[model samples]
Target chain A: MKDKIRIASGSGFWGDLQSIPLQQVTKGQIDYLMMDFLAEVTMSIMQKQKKRNPAAGYAKDLIQIMKDILPHIAEKNIKVITNGGGANPMGCVEEIVKCAHKQGIKGLKIGVVTGDDILDSIDNLLKHGAGLDNMESGQKVTDVKERLISANVYFGARPIVEALKKGAQIIITGRTTDTSLTYAPMIHEFKWSWDDWDKLAAGVIAGHILECGGQSSGGNFLGDWRSVPDLAHIGFPIAEAYPNGEFVVTKHENTGGMVSVDTVSEQLMYEIGDPTNYITPECVADFTTINLEQQGKDRVRVFGIKGKPATDLYKVSMAYNDGYTAIGSLTYSWPDALEKAKKADEILRTRLSDLGLKFDEIRTEFLGVNACHGPLASEQNEINEVVLRVGVRSANHHDIEAFGKEIAPLILTGPPSVTGFAGGRPKANEVIAYWPALMPKKLVHPKVEIITT
Target chain B: MSKIKLIDIAHGRSGDKGDAANVGIVAYDDKGYEIIKKHLTTERVKKHFEGICFGKVERFEMPNICALNFLLHNTLGGGGTVSLKHDAQGKTLAAALLKMEIEI
Candidate 1:
């Protein structure tokens, strides 16, 4: 087994920096490149695209990225694991194959993990006594059965490890846990046992630290943000993982970002619910047991992570058509701008009320005044400019469209010195709501298939 | 003892899970952690965000990292795609929490 492996994170979310994968493969020595491209609601969007066109359900940016990083990664003998597959892994694999063949690269092996998409099987599962109740609200799935756009189960690192063991150069998956993309490589390289809870949990922690790309390395750093140098060319994080369940979080040599204990600690707490119970399919990692020490400049050593056995169920993410919404904004400038914006909001709401337009919710915010923190925002007197933003949600599409049409009229009749309205009348958008539920592990199976170019 | 804002000694990040939002606050040092641990209770946090967070507040401790995580339920309108609020995901909720004053 290899003594150590270097795994580099390329992308964090679906629309993350596109050029980082090439940079990671070229600017550094790395054994594997892991990219995460899925979010909570990405699958529903991809499903909509697939419904329009059968082969367009995946992260379309991956094809361009593969075209750019193919030769470099091939020359470096680096493997790639990503959940950019979204709603379709086979389609993503096919696109990569075409990109590689076009570039005259031969004999590339691509692995595809399937069976995460269960939209077709939902009715059957429900008939078989699967409650599939919403984890938060305890509501039945049948309530939104007709509106569901996408449903996929979250798989862990085992299928990915299987793909790596089968000599696959690149692996693509659907709805895989974000942490699994980083840890699967460690399990394959070191041949770690499945039941080694500490090692598995250590891998999970490394994945969490690296999953957000540059967050652990000073990108979204809150502590001493100005101390970080060269924000323009920030380097993504790399995990120098060892066989003993220890890893050092660092970036490339002479990179633009800083990797300190502070940066890593903040990321450790990002989006986490319970410090003692970070549940994944592989193990329940305890974030409270983690230990961090700054080893050198741009390097933080993470160790002593604890985890428990895996649960008997898988968390499934489903999205449905919640309703329609439209948001419009106009900026009022100078001389009691906040007052003018508040007046504009009142005029618009009064007009909507007079027109007898009904909506589920009507919300307005003065951007420069109290948009982000709402009640907690500090009182500011005489603000130079304020963006009057209004949004309405409704089950009726016509009411949303009607709300969109009233914003531009405010500049003409309601408020003076309003200028920032460049786009045409705001259009109604379908709001896709997320439904998280759990299912028995025996009901779903992950399949790994390999394709050669 | 002196009164100071929580931002003086701590920094954090916030994210959303369904309708609930979690703000993870990490202290600058162990001393700062102790100060926050004593003063930053769930009741105080709930009272601080009285109108915004309509549900109960739950706090989790991570003394190893000198951090505390606060999960504020029903804080994001309806959260995700349905929430019409500008900060639907509650990304800036941490800064709001750090604005709280504490006696140190």
Candidate 2:
């Protein structure tokens, strides 16, 4: 077994930078390249696309990325793992195969992990006593059964490790946990036991640190953002992992971003609810027990991560057709920008109200004033400009469409010095709201299939 | 003790979890961590974000990283695609919290 391995992050989300994967394979001696391309709402979007076309549900950017990095990764013997498969891992694999064939790269074994899409099995599972209740709202899955756009289980690193052991050069999956993409490599290379809670937790923590691509390596850094060098060419983070359940988070040589203790610590706290109970299918990682030490410039050593046994439940990400929403904005300039914007908002709302138009919610914000911080925003007087943005959400599509028509009329009739209305009338679009639930582990089975090019 | 902005001694980031928003505040040192730990209670955080956050505030400690995570429920109007707010995912909520004045 290898004593150490280098795992590099290629992309963080679905629309992340495409060139970063190519840079990762060419600029460094990395053993594995893991890219995460799924988010909570991405599956529903991909499901909508799949309904339109059978072979188009996966992340299209992955094809372009594969076309760019296939040759370099093939030459360097670097394996790849990603959940860019979205709603259709098979379709993603087909696209990757075509890209490999176009590049004249032969003998590539691609692994596809599926069975996570449980939209068809939802009813059956519910009948079998799996209520699939919404974790937040306590509503049963039956309430949103007809409106579900997508429903997929979150798989862990087990299937990816199985694919790795099967000699697959690349692994594609649907709805796999973002951390599992980074953690599977350590398990495969080190031959770590499945029951090693502490080791698995250490791997999970490393995965969490590396899952955001460059976030741990100075990208989107909150601490000393100005001190980070060359963010324009920021280097994504890489994990220099050892067999002893320890790793050093660093980037490649001659890279621009810094991987300091501050940057890594900030990422560790990102989007996490309870640090002590970070649940995954593999293990329940305890983030409170983590130990981080800055070894050198662009190097932070992470160790002493503890984890508990796996839970019998798997989290389910479901998206449904929530409603229709349309947003439009008009910029109002000084001498009284905020006042003008507020006046425009009031006029538009009054017009809608007078017309007897009904909506579930009509929200307005003066962009330059308090849009982000809301009431916490400090008062600003004598502002140069403020964008009067108004949005309406409702079950009625006509109301949203009608709300869109009122913005441009305000430019001429409601407020003076109003402009920047270039995008024409805002059209009503479907809002795919998220529904997070849980299912029994015994019901969901992850399937891994190896295909060769 | 003098009045100082929370940003002077701590840095943080925020993201959404369904309708709730979580802000993780990390102190620059142990002294700063202790100072914020004593003063930055969940009640204070909820009060600090009165109009924005509409639900209960829960705080979790991570003394290893010298950080505290505050989970502000029902803060995003509905979160995800349903919310019609500019910062639907509460990405800037941490920066908003940092603007609060604290006695140090």
**Highest lDDT among the candidates is held by which one?**
1
Q: Between which residue pairs do clashes occur in model 1?
A: none
lDDT of 1 by residue, A300-382 (tens): 99989889999988999999998899999999998989888989999999999999999999999889889998888886887
Error of 1 at A417 (Å): 1.2
For candidate 2, write residues B1-104 as lDDT tens digits.
88988898999889999999999999999998998899899999999999999999999999999999999999999999999999999999888888889876
Model 1 chain A poorest ten-residue lDDT run: A123-132
Q: Give all TM-scores, in the order shown.
A: 0.99, 0.99
List model 1's recovered fraction of native interface contacts, to 2 decimals: 0.84
Per-residue lDDT tens digits of candidate 2, residues A144-174?
Answer: 8999989999999999999999999999999
**TM-score of the second chain, cand. 2:** 0.97
